[model samples]
Target chain A: MIEFIQALRDPDIAFLRYAMAAGLLAGIAFGIIGSFVVVKRISYLAGSIAHCVLGGIGAALYLQQVYGLTWADPILGALFAALSAALIIGVVSMYAREREDTVISALWVLGMAAGILLIAKTPGYTDPMSYLFGNILMISSADVWIILILDTVIIVISMLFYNRLQAVCFDEEFARLRGLNTRMLYLLLLGLTALTIVLLIRIVGIIMVVALLSLPAAIAGQFCGRLWQMMIAAAVISMLCIAAGLCLSYSLDLPGGATIVMVTGCIYLAGFSVKALRR
Target chain B: MMPQPVISFNNVCFAYDQTEILHNVSFNLFEHESVCIVGPNGGGKTTLIKLILGLHHPASGSIRVLGGMPHANSRRIGYMPQSTHFDPSFPISVLNIVLMGRLGRRPGSFYSRSDKAAALQALAQTGLVDLAARPFASLSGGQRQRVLIARALACEPELLLLDEPTAHVDPAMEQQVNDTLARLAHRLTVITVTHELGFVSRMVDRVLCVNRTVKLHPTSEITGEIIQEIYGSDLKMVRHDHQCSQQGHTHD
Candidate 1:
């Protein structure tokens, strides 16, 4: 832990600072949207969106490595894929005649499958594990800036439309009766969740993104009495988890994302157990 | 000229896919009238309310609310649904839930001082002012029902629509809800969809019995026999330990 703290200040290892900054910045978005996802019980939808991001990452890698497209950053591709998946799922859940669960399941698997196949075909020595499970230490200064910008946008919009989103999530039918355009509000929520999921993909990777997104907020729900309180608590919890996980992983030489997720899971389990025992 | 009906449903018919839920249903509810909509489980009681709220469009006829199209005048109506679908573990205060009643004001805008005042007033009306800071999930079933009622009242609506307000409440809480609705009925046009036969006599001036079609009867015209005859043994009446028609209304 001491070594990890020293590493953050070491000029030679600026990546450590970038990784910490990125994780903390992205945690704000995770906390805000994850509370909605937990309260609205849409973690399943978020999981599908998170898995779909790998497809975009793989496609970007393929295009950049094989076709030599200079602008094909994996992050941009991830944003595209997350928003597209959110729209498709949103439209299908709301308007499509097809079964909702079947579509969600299809997107969940097909995205992962396409990503693996595309990664396999991308020329020389590309490690899929690094993307499948994130390596926060690999994040650059540019990634930190992107995370900060996305975080600001999410926080602003979420606070701006807090009451409407709360109304829509709590009782959609009643919200519609109040003439709140609930359908559009619902789509907007899913869109915000998509953007947050994209930021989450950087710190936790696609496989464990939903856990990091939902766990802190779910834990916060146990302590806070209101939605905004839960958001604030969850964000603080998320940043603490990231900081602790980074220190532990650095000291113990373990995988960063897995360590972070395990820390979150342990806290949730501990809280659950304590509550059960008290009862 | 006669004053406009608060809600006018003109030969309205609603179908889900090919199944006809409500066929050629017609009714005119006037201003300040209290009506109870009662029927069997699948008798389109809720579908009628949906049409009036403009959540669903009729397959055939037009519906008017507050002298305008249903959707256009939706802000003038307050609704409390049978059940609010949400996670019980959700973090929301009773006051915050009630404030949702004032949702028609622009999306990006914050709740005004009047909105908060209105919510607190509604809470007071439902006898829930003391519980305003309480978590909505922490409330008992009856308290939650009243909170929903307060939410509906907070809209300051011209017409209030309540779907099954007393379904799961205890008798004591049921009486409280009855009192609240009775008090509100004096000022606004109130429509409640309930299956409780006793609620018909105690709360409203008229009963709107809906099957595939709708029939309006004055409260004096409703009896245990008429209900049994209309519902065909499918409707279960909550008799409160008395034999059917023990309240002195004859079967015939």
Candidate 2:
């Protein structure tokens, strides 16, 4: 514990500052969006979207290697894939309500397959493990800036549409009757979720992203009565988990993303047990 | 001669996946008229209401609400869907649920002070003002139904539509709900879809029995025979005297 605190003040360890900042920002964004995702019961949709990010990463790698495109940033490729997947899933679910789960499952597998194929076809050795399971220590200054901008956009949009979001999440059919354009709002929410998944990919990796997105909100939901309260509590809880996970990972030499998810999972189980005891 | 009906369905036909649900259905609902739509399950009762609310469009012919397209005048129509569809575990306050009705009136992005006042007024009308701050999940089934009704009332709509307001509710709570609707019927046009023939009151001036076809009858014309024919089964009708007796016995 003393060594961890000493490392925090060490000037030589600049990456720790970046990792901590990324964790905090990701926690805030995840908390706000995850509350809606959990309440709306679209965690499956979120999982599909997280896995779909790999397709973007693979495509960017392929494009950069074959065509020598310097601007083929994997993150941009990821953003494009995630957004497209979100739209496709949203439209399919809306129009084909009964077959939604089947379609989502198909898309989930297809996304991972496409990513693997594209990466294999690329004429270069790529370390797939880092992308599959996140390596927060690898987050660059440029990555931090993109994350900051995305977080700001998420915060602004969520604040502006707070009431509309609440209404839709509570009752979509009723929201439509009020002339709120529910379909459009639902698509916008899915889009935001996709972007949030992209932001979280660097911290938790694609496989574990959904855990980071959902666990804090689930814990918060158990204790909070209102949507906004759940969001705030989730944010605080997420930050604590991320900070703890980071410190533990550094001291124990464990993988950061998995460690964070484990911490979150433990906290969630603890919360459930406490509620059970009260009952 | 008569004020234009708040809702008019002219030769409307609707189908789902090639299976016709409502065929050539025509109806006219005037202002301040309370009507009940009763039918067996899958008898197009819900289909008719969806058309009126603009959630579903007629396959043939035209439907109008408030002298305009159904979608255009949607703000003037309040709707209460079946309570079974609601997720009780969702994190929301009763007041917040009611406040959703004011979304139509929001000119700017933010809700106005008047919107909050209107929500509270609606809650008070439903006798849920004291529980406004309560979590909606903690409410009983009847209370949840009333909260939904309050949500619709908050819209201050001229026409109100409720889909099975009394379904899954206890007999006493059903009476309370009917009384609330009866009171609202004095000023607003109330259209409800219900299977509980016993809950019908004098306030419901008309009854539309639907089964892929519609038969309009004055409330006085509704009888056990008609209900049996419409539902294709022997169904008993609770007489007004029986309801009075039940109420008195319960109180005693």
Candidate 3:
């Protein structure tokens, strides 16, 4: 514990500031996206995408182990796989019958299996378990910049298309009839959701991302009377969860992502209980 | 010469897969009249309303609202879905739901003070001003229906299409909704699809009894014989369960 705090005290890891900043930024994105995911009932989708990351990492690691391909960034490989699946599910939803849910669920498992298998095949290259859960402490400056940029872009796009998103979420048919071009909107939202899962991979871990995306919104639903309020409330709760988890991890020397998710779950349970009691 | 029908349906046909929902439907709805589509369950009454509101396209025929295609004039029509279809668990205030009527007024526009005032006024007009701040999910059946009516009115519509406006409210508020429709008919060209034959018979200027095909009757022509011909069952003392009725009204 002393070494960990001492490590933080080190000016050599001066970039801890950036890691926290990026984590907060990513938290904002997750919170906003999480708001709609709760309203539209897509937390399961978030979970599926997170688990699918294992497949992406696994493939990248396996290729590097067997063929001597660079494993420097296995997540990129995971990202490719995750994005590919996201797009496939997106297309299937339009053309197929009630099978998009099934496809997404299938990909969730497949993504995990593929990642674990590739990791097994690969020559040991830095335990990829961190990627599955996440390693916030080890986040690179480039990773921070990428997360900041993605969150900023998502925020701007959300603001720019705020009305359109609102229209789409509340009444899709009414939105389409109003000349909103709903098909393009659906793809865009799905793509953004995929990107959000990818961004959250480092801080919250793939397995725990669903909690980050769902807990705040579920709690916020009680207080928020509108979409924008709901988003803000989620963001606030998420930041608190992130901060509290980091503090607790610092004290307990535990896995940060799991700690954060556990904190969020507690908040969710407390809120759920209070709500139920009030009812 | 035609008095420029506000809504014109030229041989409109709609089907769900193989079974036809609306077959060779044609009609002209004028600016000054209120019309209702009355039919049995699964008889395409809601389908006709959807075609008018541009929520669904006809299978083979063309539909025009206010001299343009339905989609083109989406801004001109205000639609209130059936009360049975509204979601009780939806997280929104009566005021916010009402303001949604202005969503199509302009794309990417912020709600102005005038818009706020208009929503408030509509709520007041529908006797829902007291419930405006209440969460929609917490409202009683009658009040929720009133909020939706307020939502439809918030648009200041030149044309209004309601699907079963009174299908969930108590018999007391059902009359209130019917009265609100009666008032709206003076300004907007109102076309509602309903099963409330008792109230619709008096409030609507015309009625369209729909099944696979449709039969349009001027209000003056409707009689006991026509009801016997269409429903094949009786609405004489029947009412939809308010609890089950409010299940998915917003989904409409």
Candidate 4:
């Protein structure tokens, strides 16, 4: 702990500052979006979208290696893949309600398989481990700026459409009757979830992204009486968990992403037990 | 001049997956008319309601609400789906749920003071004003149903649609809901789908017995024979007075 605190003050380890900043921003975004994801029962869809990011990362890596495409950043590729998957899933769920689960499961596995194939075909000795299990130490200043911009966009959009979003999430049929264009709202929500998943990938990676996205919100749901309160509580819980996880991982020489997810999961279980005991 | 009907369905036909639900269903509900749509399960009753709410479009013919298409006038039409569809464990307050009714009315992101006042008034109408701060999940089944009703009332709609409002409610609470509907019927055109014929209040101006087709009857003209014909069963009509007497006997 002493070493870690000293390292934070050391100018040589400036990446720690960026990592902490990224964690805070990602935490807030995940908390807000995750509340809706849990309440709307779309965690399964979120999981599918997270895995789909792997396909984009692999594709971008392969393209850059083989075609020498300098502009093809893996993060940009992941964003594109996440957004497309979100749109496809959103449209399918809306129009083909009966086959939604089957289609989502198919896409979920296909996305991962496609990612593995693309990564295998890449010429260079590319290590996909870092993408799968995130390394917060790998986050760059550019990545931090991307996260900040995405966070700002998400916060503004959520603030602007909070009531409409709540109405749609609570009862879509009623929202439709209110002339709220519920379909558009649902698409917008999925889009936001996609963006949030991208932000979380930096902190927890694709494999554990859904946990960070959902667990905090689920814990907050246990105590909060309102959606906004749940969002705020979840955000605070996420930040605390991330900070603790970061310190623990650094002290013990553990993997940062997995450690954070483990901390979040433990806290969620504790919260659930407390709620059950109260009941 | 006679006021335009609040809702009109002219030869509207709807089908699901090649199975016809509503067949040439034609009807008109005028201003301040309260109608009860009662039919057997899977008998196009919900289909009619959905059509009116613009959730489903007609395959043929026209359906209009408030002098326009159902979609065009959706803002003026308040809807309350069955309470069973709501997740009881969802984290929301009674007031927030009620305020959702004003989503269409509010021009801004936040609710205006008048919007809050209207929501509070709607809660008051349903006798839930005091419980505004209570978590919706903690409310009793009947209270939750009332909260949904309060949400519908928050729209300040000229036409109100309710589906199976008293389905899972106990008799006393059912009576309370019916009373609230009765009071609202004086101001808005109310359409409800219910199975409990005994719970139908005197405020119902008409009864539309829907099967594959719709048979409209003035409330005063409804008879047990007509109900039997509509249901295609020997179901008996239990009057509200008889239910009250039965409750009184149980108490005694």
| TM-scores for every candidate against the unseen true structure | 0.95, 0.95, 0.86, 0.93
Q: Write the per-residue lDDT of candidate 4 for residues B130-175, one digit (tens) a residue.
A: 9999999998878988899999899998888999999989887887
For model 3, how does the per-residue alpha-carbon lDDT over B1-252 read when each residue is reduced to its tens digit?
759989888898998889888889888878878888888899988788777777689989899889898877876777777666544565777887777776656656567778889999999888888888888878888788778778778878788888778877788877787778788787778888787666665667788889878888776676667777897755364434322111122211
User: Who is ahead in lDDT, 2 or 3?
Assistant: 2
lDDT for position A133 in model 4? 86
Candidate 1: residue pairs that collide: none
Interface RMSD of 4: 1.0
Question: Predictions ranked by DockQ, top down?
Answer: 1, 2, 4, 3
Residues B95-126 of candidate 2 have per-residue lDDT tens digits of 99999999967556678889999999999888
What digit string (tens of lDDT, one per residue) describes model 3 on residues A1-279?
A: 465557567778754555566667788887788887787676777678778878877777777777778854765875777677667766777777666788878888888887777787777755767876777777888888888888888898888877677667766665665456777877677777778888878877778788888888888987777778888888888888887777677678888889888999998999889888998
Question: Cα RMSD (Å) between model 4 and the true structure?
Answer: 3.6
For DockQ, candidate 1 versus 3, the one ahead is 1
Determine which window of 10 residues in candidate 3 chain A has minimal summed lDDT: A14-23
In the order shown, the candidates' DockQ scores are 0.76, 0.73, 0.34, 0.72
Give me candidate 1's interface root-mean-square deviation.
Answer: 1.2
Collision count of model 3: 13
lDDT for B45 (candidate 2): 92
